[model samples]
Target chain A: MTRALYQFLLWLHPPFFRQRFGEEMLWIYDESAATHGVLALFTDGLASLARQWVMRAGTWKLAVAGAGGLLEILMAGFFVMGPAPTAHVAATQSIEDPAQFSGTWKGSLRSRPIELVLAKEGTVWRGEIHFQSPDGALRSAPLEDIRVAGDSVHLRVQVDDSDMTFSGKLVPGTLGSRLVGALQATADASDDLISYSTLQAFHA
Target chain B: MREDLSPLVPLSPAILHILTALAGEERHGYGIMQEVARQSEGQYKLGPGTLYDNLQKLLEHAVVEECSRRSAADNPRRSAGDDPRRRYYRLTAFGRRVLLAEVARLEGVVRHARLRLQTNNPRRAS
Candidate 1:
């Protein structure tokens, strides 16, 4: 029956759907599978296959029908069965060594003061801009999209629409100095705001 | 209940984790990643690429909404002048309803299975 077919599709589709929605979907699936047994899973897989075939047929209604039919099956099962059981995943990295970029440096943008926080973690350098805006209020923006090569630093920041690159050299025991180059934005009259600067060095 | 079920297609594990993490409170991308890791006891880790991709999809579906920047009263960690570094997310009413319904549906399935298993096994009854 239509209900049986719907239960089957729920089983066939990989748990990718649950990942996008919520774990509740997986919980529901687990419950449904437990009640219906392997038959429900098999039915879902077969229905998915049939829909894939119909999609390849190149007709409009059949394609729509295949999609609509599959959807009906999921809804019917959802209302009757509830949520499916779900599994979880974790993140690979953690933020450590927060002090690497703790020092202060001074720079300028068109003669405006740009104070930076240069934190060094081993060799990788993280920089932050700590400066007062034109209104004399302190603000900060992360030096995102960083690329450090040897003693030279190459990075760009967006001010409005133009991307301005900062090319600088590392001065040992001194504030690194760099020149700003302007690049055209997709649109006119927009310029990227230049923020922080730092040399990329390997921490020994 | 039968208007259109296509949008409610079961989500992937990664997407589900993001949604589940946001079920109780709002969190940005990084916060969701951290919480999911903790909830799973570090078993299922989602990389940046996977996390963001799933987030984009969820945003499109309107299941999760971006929260406003935390006010000073809301975030104790806010430094005096530090720019806000985090984005927050929360579940929509529709999303909550769907999640609850799904939970009930699954529970029903589990109850039926338990009954069948017990009834089919005389040893279990004894």
Candidate 2:
């Protein structure tokens, strides 16, 4: 039964994945089938289907295909809606070079802590933060949307359902300093805030 | 509630590999292939078809996430001058937690096997 189900998934995959990976994948399927038998074929098929669903769920079509049609439809709905904003931000901004952002910057938000680390890759930055409220509750979020422009650095921090964009000027001296300009949330208003004393670069 | 049991349990090795690749960072299809190869030290080579198929299953499980659209420039395997958009992937916290659990489960099997082997061959244990 598992083998049959595997075969069925394989049959469902080519049309779905070929649209993105081009014709090369079809040849791969043929080659894998020649060597690894039905198991390899099924593995290949399942992998392709997994890739499509992850990368191209936005393009999925829900037309009934067979006994699995209902499953497909249900999966489509889950794919479209699962992974709320937090998941989206993490997945989208997972690539950050910690060297570039390895500095301490101060901002003024009473609720959130602001610390950025720039790593060796030279292009990406990861911001680590801590949030503390008056009631003494603590929370933390990783800031992935970091952009460096000339002497200015921009950091986007997502807290819960809202995204806050912070623009700061890099102060030049023996050490790098950042002065916060304005902090605004992208969507939905929340009382959670961030504040800094003096932004300082820290060696990671 | 019992019927609510997972429809798909005991995910395939390919699916596990795909999930493990995304656990640290987001990767595109080829990126995933490369990472999986690296992780297994080339023991597991996933062709494009197989890579994408496993990706779909992980996506269905919400264990893998699509990070973004990639241009040719984003593809490390592409020539430096060639630019095309390629999607990136990352493991959700849920995905990471689940993968860790799966790893523990697999480790349990290995531990049991080792115990059996040791019992069967006392010299091997030494």
Candidate 3:
């Protein structure tokens, strides 16, 4: 919910401003959102929205000849109106069998053990993730944006300020099965994907 | 080119702290936040709004520039603490000049303040 509002404010910025620093701002927000208070986080985003519109060009580097105005309008439209740019894997990927991922599995991520749980609820997939934090404490987060495409699987869980996304394929080995993919924590579901590759496959 | 950074001199507390944080190496927003607190020993705390507000201005004035994420996290200081790998910002050449100018300007101010206070002290004046 707070993230939804943060994105909404991000959407409110001028097209040019959004084009340059949308993901950057969101990245920073996610980094601190876990440790900082909500008031501090939202206040910064709200003020930036107002400032970006008023300041015009905080980091404007127009490399093109006359495409500035045109690019601004197009980007603005894309952000405000969906449909045209909704071909992302999260939306385009189809689930052949959601039941395949309907069990708890464990794997090593970032050299730390991670556990993920997925359950289908009336055609909808829902689950949570668990991992050991830096302080040697266990932390868990609910799963969101569960996308499955044939053997490809993608799951995102909101951990503190950032979204931890897992993308791997289900591999059938002689010894049971494993979800072999990389788990990455990103600033947003879309925008920029910061790939901290963890190739440890989880076995049920 | 020796640009006149005097107009931008006497940087605001927030901007100065931010530039100082970026002075050593490129950093993400969270890195900057942590650096500011560490440098100031928690005397000065800059929320995200103020940091970016000033950062936007710094970028506008060409005092700062963005760089790739990989280049930032590969620094020697990565082991010093935990700074998440996010979009990174570095002080541009022009930005370094502005920061040095501000620092020099602050140095003079501190010197003058110390001398003035010392002279006003009865024991020191004697």
Q: Model 3 in CAPRI terms: which quality?
A: incorrect
- Candidates ranked, most accurate by TM-score first: 3, 2, 1
What residue runs in model 1 are displaced by over 4 Å at the alpha carbon? A1-204, B1-6, B70-85, B122-126
Q: Give a tens-digit lDDT track for model 1, residues B56-107.
A: 4555345665543333226554456633334456776766765665666668
> In model 3, which regions exceed 4 Å deviation?
A55-204, B68-85, B122-126
Identify the candidate with maximal lDDT.
Answer: 3
Q: Choose the strongest candidate by TM-score.
A: 3
The i-RMS of every model, in angstroms, reads: 14.8, 15.0, 11.8
Query: Residue A66 lDDT in model 2?
Result: 32
Q: Which candidate is the best by DockQ?
A: 3
Report chain A TM-scores, every model: 0.32, 0.38, 0.47
Query: Which model, 1 or 3, shows the larger DockQ?
Result: 3
Worst 10 residues of 3 chain B by lDDT: B77-86
Candidate 3, position A90, lDDT: 32
How well does each candidate superpose onto the true structure, as a TM-score? 0.35, 0.38, 0.49
Residues A53-128 of candidate 1 have per-residue lDDT tens digits of 3331123444455556566667767776755322111111111223432466555432246665566667566766
TM-score of chain B of each: 0.73, 0.75, 0.82
Q: In order, what lDDT does every prediction score? A: 0.49, 0.54, 0.69
